[model samples]
Target chain A: MSTTIKVARPVDWTGIFFAVVLTLVIVVPLLVVGTWAFTNVWRFPSVIPQEFGLKFWYQTLARADVWSSITMSLTLATTVTLISAVICLPAAYAFARMDFPGRDILFFSFLAGHAFPKFGLLVAIAGIFLQLNLIGTFWGVVLIQLVGTLLFMIWIPVAAFQSVDRRMEEAARDVGASPFRVFWSITLPQAGPTIAAALLLSFVGTFYETEGAWLIGAPQVRTLPVLMISFINNQPVIQYGAVLSVLLWVPSFIALLFARRVVNSGSFAKGFGA
Target chain B: MSVLTIKDVTKLFPGGTKAVDSFSLEVADGELVCLLGPSGSGKSTLLRMVGGFETPSAGLIAIDGEDITRMPPEKRPTGMVFQSHALWTHMDVFKNLAFGLKLRRLPATEIKRKVEAVLELVGLGGYGSRRVTQLSGGQQQRVALARSLVLEPKILLLDEPFASLDQHLRERLREEVRDIQQRVGITTLFVTHGQDEALSMADRIVVMRDGGTEQIDRPDVVYRNPQTPFVAGFIGTMNLLEGTVANGIFTRASFSHPLAVADGPATLAIRPEALDVTPAEPGAAKVHRVTDYGTHGLLDLDLPDDTRLKAMVSHPAQYRHGMGVNLTPRAVSAYRNNAQIFRSEA
Candidate 1:
């Protein structure tokens, strides 16, 4: 009889340290918010809530205003994802495969939006949105979200498409595939997951956006982040804000899982090299 | 009529590099021509222009007497095997082969038949269902070949297709490619930097250098009677000796030969195999180095005047370093300022 033996891998201390740090930095906050959403009465520096109930989660869900904010944020995020993907695909393709005068400078300029804090830029753009009568409108928030996500979508696929082999497209063309067909069949398929990653990243970015959504989407068209901010300021307890935060975190967590899967699939370059 | 004709083609890149310059060649139907050159010699650029991947800055390309210079690659009737094989990693073998036929809107039955036929032709009859990533390098190469040939293109262009394989596999694959090409009788333009590959595979060879055509002729003629010094030196190793030709007699400082050609200040080019070396008590040449392969060896010798000569010897074990040896030219090719003046009769 033959038996199989399982071998154990040595513990990675550095990885474990990073994992713990990440959990503390990210997961612990979510857990605290979730606990706060259920706690009827809780105090900081106390390990557990003195009292517990579902009143805050129930109240937040039943609010017509909260429902409207959720709906508006969802619509704005979907619109931004669609628009940014459409605009970023061609821009990324050109940056990856073509050469033009001042190309690097132009591409770098696309990334210049990240050099400064968004709060500063939103403050300056608030005046323009005000003059255009776009402040507090759904389109106004969507426009700001599109600009924020375009930099990410364009940059991600540019690096992804550059990693894709140019010879595949050339081979497709040699075998009678048109420019459109070559992109549809070769370039897009090879970089499909990366493009997906970009879209999900854009969706997540727009979903969690606070500064621009607060500055541009307040009062008239209340997005989730704006409502949560107002709730936190107006209410003495943090439970209502924690309830809204947990609701918003759900879709972002799902998007992150999908992006991680797309990245870890790692099957794009399997047959190219020996 | 020629199947393909490139007339005065020149490709000037954006940064002032002339990748291909004034290159012209006519490929007849069912003829396999090899473009042989070192790297950066513009051989690939010429092939790309034919395949429509590149557009020549100046000149025209025509197929079957119709101008295709302005046509896009997909509209041209050509197939190319890339150096990297470029198989679709995400696709199964069948999907990869059926992609072009599907683009052409062929019927399912016809696509299946053609795909199966080419799969069998390339010796991969049952490989259609396999994922490309699971296949070996040689298998992937065949799949790449089958993918292109299934389309039945009017012309086939191969760009160093076997460069990535092991040496043994490369030799076998190259022979398989030659056999398939001949059996199909497709007009082929093969690009290679290897002289041995060009010599073995091409019906006619086009020797290129510095984005220009050096010589274009049959393999035997290009080898036996090169038109220029560059062609002679580039095709294989050749020793260049400076001399003067007068009244059908060529004379060097310490050697003389009776030629049957014109008189001028000339350069003599002799291939290593054309020089006969033998041991002598007192000889003008002294053996400097000897490198032996299993079948043959190379003897690098120097004359008293500091002229270095290399000769191939069949009896490699008999030669040693710093030994005195006598050399006699069995045949010599004379070139005057890059133009061929004469070659000794065989």
Candidate 2:
């Protein structure tokens, strides 16, 4: 099938080749940083490290801030995940199913916020939190991350709920089931895999994100990304930032490996939208 | 008693499309009435309004003389079997049937017995534990039936319920549905575009078109005597010939058929089977085309003018070359009820 399908144009070939080069260039740097975390030293401008040991890993654990950073990252991600699910489920349903005045305007406003980078809101958001005396609270870090989490995660579930057949709900209503019962039984069960995928994506994505956490959060509420940055600044010669990167990415990576079902169903439900 | 009454009910959707315009019907208890129409003819919208899935823009609906115009579907004593089965895909057959009962908080023992009995009634006794998708299309449809039957609705409504099944399966399931309807004797209102389905299964057929009732008659009466040109054209395959009526006898274009019109100019309609091939006589027609349809041949007879009349004849054993065929239309019907027929503008 592949051989006889069609002749490839030069433009298509160049596009494919350029994409592969770009992916390799970006991924290889992250791969090196990951491998360097376990090795003893980076000798020169060589592709591979000369000395390999776990001295940096042991010394990085010796600092108590490593544990605090792990806890901070976990807490901020968990809180963001809970808030996103609670706030976004109803919002997504309202956007998908109901019709009111200014509905399209409201939806487009959400899309605008989603398009705007989180860094644009960082300084003003920090100032607001400081004035409210919530700067040192763990919940403060979560509030700073809330806007992006709702935009990105709610879009997935909104598309999921809309793809469901309205006839199914009508059929349930015809068979003596109330509207709420139909929503609970037929609608939500079908949306299970998408919700799970969105929850995982929001939590894991926020865990590794540095911009929101680094700018708005105070010193006492430092997340793993902020902690990792401070650790690198204090021990520039030790290269513990590389260790912290691997440490931070491992849990999220494992969660993602088992997330194929969630992604497959979420992507299928989220057709032509997110 | 009138089990269901739709009195002056009208549904005006957005943009002024009157889906069901001032429609009304009084279905007697235990009668199976089929609302028959082509798509976009407001048959389904009427059914939806009755089921409360749609709120009518005008008029009122009553079940057993109680007005339920604004009542939600679940609150009404009505159940509907959807065309696609609409079985709870995530649930097993057992839970699917017992869903409404469980929601109403029926006792577990009564729910168990009712579910078991209906499942057996639908010939899916052992399929209770199986997922709805795991079942065949026929089985899933039976599950839908069981789900609605468990509710014991005063009148059961079906929206092209067996349409998704194959021809043979649909025939068998409609027979099953009829038998169950007879045994339980609940009033039923089913909708279908297929004439054969409505004719064979319904106690009374309501033919709808252009948001109004075209004809409401029994199957045999409707087939033998159609009330309007649209009903005749839509219900079944009819060989129509354009003719004019003056005095009493109708003057067809080619051959003058002995049709009796009531008042003014008219059009006469004849079923293909009404005309038969006879031995060629002085005023008879000559055969133009013959289509052999297994046991019978559908022949088109050319008259003096270019007007060709259709006839259905059983294949004779000795049909040979140069054998001339005659035409005879017996016990046929004529309509001059409206001048629209001769206009030919519609």
| Per-residue lDDT value at A51 in model 2 | 85
True contacts kept of each: 0.84, 0.72
lDDT of 1 by residue, B1-346 (tens): 1398989999999999999998899999989999999999999999999988888999999889889998999888888999999999988999999999998999999999999999999999988999999999999999998888999888889998888888888888888999999999999999999888899899999999999988999998999899998898888788888878889777776566777777878888888999999898577688889999879999998877778888999988888877888778898888887898787854
Top candidate by TM-score: 2
Give TM-scores for every candidate, taking all chains together and pairing residue i with residue i.
0.88, 0.90
Docking tier of model 2: it is medium
lDDT by residue (tens digit), candidate 2, B35-82: 999998899998888899899888888998899999999898898889
The candidate that wins on DockQ is: 1
- Chain A of model 2 scored by TM-score: 0.84
**Residue pairs whose backbone atoms clash in candidate 2:** none
Measured by TM-score, how close is model 1 to the native structure?
0.88
Question: Interface RMSD (Å) of model 1?
Answer: 0.8
Which stretches of candidate 1 lie above 4 Å from their native place? A1-31, A38-45, A50-59, A100-105, A115-117, A254-274, B15-17, B244-264
Encode model 2's per-residue lDDT on A1-274: one tens digit a residue. 3567687665778889999999899898888887889889677887678888899889888888888788888988988999888888878778878998997777667666557665767777778878998777877778877776766577777777886778777878877777788878888787777777778878887898787677667567778888888877877654688988888778678668646775666653463355
